[model samples]
Target: MGNSNQKLQEEKYENVMKKFKLKESLQHTQLGMVRIYNLKDDNNYSIFEFHKTATTSEEAKLMLTHYKNRKCYNNDHLTQIFFISEQHSQILCQDQTQFIIIGEFFYNNIQNEMKNYIQKNNSFPEARLWQITLQIVNACTYLETNGRNHGEIKSKNIYIHPDQSVKLIEYNFIYGSMNGYQKALLLNDFQYLAPELLKEVKAKKSSPNIDFIKGDVFALGLTLLELASLNSCEQYYDWISKEVHTDKIIKANDLLLQKGYSTLFTNLIYQMISDVDIRPRFSDLKEVLSHFENQINNNVDFYSKYQMRQSNQFNIYNSVYTQQYQRPGQINQAQSIYLPNGSY
Candidate 1:
């Protein structure tokens, strides 16, 4: 009976996948197999497929309940969800169940963005940092308000648009409830985990004792630090594994300052990566970001000066500029500020 059911589920999943025209094999991420597919309507979408061992029918029901009617996906900073497997078809198997997720296709992620910056020996300005901070904080806050926590928040999980806007991606819904697969995956990516989370894992705790929302805050701080320093998290594996000590944090903070980032911005990164109890809530971070935004609005000349420096460093001879490094801080007092696209 179990074998028959497993075979049936596989057939159903294959039939559904056959409907879409497979474009290219993108990459095998920690989440699952990500591929580009074209719908019958000729629209391209990224499909995320993962398989987990099927223990019971309850698992599928829980997944469907969570994926369906999720209001968090509507936020602009989050990767929008277009389709979920259980909504379209009942895809469950006795041995392994397959989950398919279709969402908007983004061209670049923060990880690759960092690589580009590093290759060019460029660093993010304070204005650019504020833009990313505001958007990511809003995304996290929305998820928290909707009663969800993105257990993994890292550079790779963040997509970057040509305008320098970012969207947090690859939210594993099975993180807290169904722990077998996601828990194992997160444990493997330990550099991004908060200190409290690391302590719990080291003690082999069954569930989290600390708020996962605060954990997301810590990860966000580290991500900002990486962007500010033009360094990847992998480069700071030793420091991150040690719970982000003052020495390493100070080094990164000092690097940002040397690159002309304000002390206020660097200081917030410290407070964020600090111990869980010392960490400020997302609201607190937003308050700081608002202050930073005000500073940007009031200091248009200062921001434009930084942009000029950036442009000069990039190319003085070329008449046209690449989309990635195009001037984002060229706002005037008469124009709306905060984001290049006029989004707050």
Candidate 2:
């Protein structure tokens, strides 16, 4: 079977080269960056990120064999990540609700670069992923709007694709945490947790309380804030605060609270975080992000100002995909102004 998989992998490489009208670049990624490229039928390219220590799960092994032959959403790079088949056995850990590993190696370079970029360019993903983020947010909102709640949201659990698409993976919890151990519980890392969950997780107070659906909205709002900071001038919000363990998303609400959206985010957080009926429900969160999107778009006017900022000296993005300057699309066209990340 391993040999069969290898044969299939080689065939994919050959096929990719032919379709893309190119050869493998064999670029060096950071240690553990194990990505396999797949040539799209024509003029298109995609990649798969796999775990170094392939699991015993026969399904992941099988999926890998003909993976290149499959048709993916194409827009979503999350397709690159690995996931246990819902029908298969179960998720990996106790606390984690769902588990999927797209690639063994993710953006080590990008994370470091974003740190410097925040110091120089003052943003993350430079806007490429921002467009993707909105799609994910909309998807989450649609879930609750349609009466489906995502249950939890975390940066590590979400995938940002190079093609500007988002995949909100790791849903093992909706069925119940992997291995039937929901008691593993979350901590500061519960970024998408609801107000009541926070009360429990923080005080080390455990309970059978499960209202994951409404909780997802709070997490979704926090996610927007995360995507926003990827390029906001106030990129320091999460890091400067207690972003370390987001089991309860303390910093997310705090940052928004400080952003002068105090009336909006703070009230939302306070209500949602409430032990009583003050907590907003999932539908309420959908309204909040919708309003938030419109609020930033109207108040900031990013795209218009960006278009006008186009020039030659600094050449604030003279081309469709700018280098040393321009990056296409209004990554996060929010209203808040930020200083450069210093890379320029």
Candidate 3:
């Protein structure tokens, strides 16, 4: 009976792999080697993330269990884990080989998108920053309500689709913690680590017994600052190293003010990253965001009219300059110009 069960498992593994066609190697993410794959019939596409060196069946099983339990809750900002293969577990434990997990395919991440946008535009737009920050906070609130904590909340883990929608990924770290498994490694970018977690790590504790939800709030605060300043976490870390707690807050607020971010937004970020005992709950953060959303809606018509007037002025200037430079026989043709969309 044991031999027959083992044979069936092997056959099942082979069958599962046969259904997907490996397309091409993608960039190496922190999780593992990401690759694109399509169904054999070319009807569907998915992302296959393989971790040959670091993955173990024990860790994979923990992740799979958590995925199954939490799969019912769906939000636009959370990436969906489509399937996890039991065959990968067999390979990891029995064959002492790699394992793979599959998830929705995303073309870009927030880190890369921000970098590219800054390179082309020289600055991050306030409206887009508010939208992205709101989406992330909304995701955090959803997880909080669902009794889950996103242990890792960094820009690299936030995926952005081509349509500019955002989704948070990489939940294995969170699930591993719930299973009482300590992460073998620590992320190098410690800027996002909450102060309490850092203190625990400095004390050489095996696992930081801190409130992870609050830790996520701290990370989101820094993320908002990074977005507003158009600077990477590394740059923010360097700037933060020179200041004490109060000085850090002052500096962040001043920098954001120079960038034209409203005082309300800056204050909310400050409150979120404040001391663990004093940090506002997710509900408070959501309320603040709601106020901003309403304000934006109320001012939409004013902004539209302002932009239209600016466009008309630019066109008139261009036409007058062209008329002055043109020869006597040349005809001045009116050109239709559309304003660029800024809703993203």
Error of 1 at 327 (Å): 34
Best by TM-score: 1
Q: How many backbone clashes does candidate 1 have?
A: 0
Give me the displacement of residue 258 in model 3, in angstroms.
2.4
TM-score (C-alpha, index-matched) for candidate 2: 0.42
- lDDT per residue as tens, model 3, 1-344: 64575567667656666778788777644444577776677544455545432256566566666657655558888876555444422442463323345566765777786787688876566566667777887887888888876766667777786567678764553344321112312433344666666655555577666887887887777777776677755443432242224335435544564455544455556666667776655655666567466544344331232222223232211223233112112211221111012110
- C-alpha lDDT values of all predictions: 0.59, 0.39, 0.56
lDDT of 2: 0.39
Candidate 2: where is the Cα deviation over 4 Å?
1-35, 38-45, 49-136, 144-152, 163-166, 173-183, 186-195, 198-209, 221-276, 288-344
RMSD in Å for candidate 1, one decimal? 10.4
Tell me the tens digit of each residue's lDDT in model 1 across 268-311. Answer: 67667766665676766665567456665444433344332333
Candidates sorted by TM-score, descending order? 1, 3, 2
Ranking by lDDT: 1, 3, 2
Query: What does each candidate score in C-alpha RMSD?
Result: 10.4, 14.2, 13.4
Expressed as tens digits, the lDDT of each residue in 1-344 for candidate 2 is 64575566556545434543322333332212234445446223444432333234653455444333222323232233323321122246422111222322222223343356566755333133334334554665555444444544645455544443455533532222331113324323324454455555545555546566556544544545554355322232242232223322334444442333322333333333334343445444444446446544345433333332223112222323323122233423232222132110
Q: List the residue pairs that clash in candidate 1.
A: none
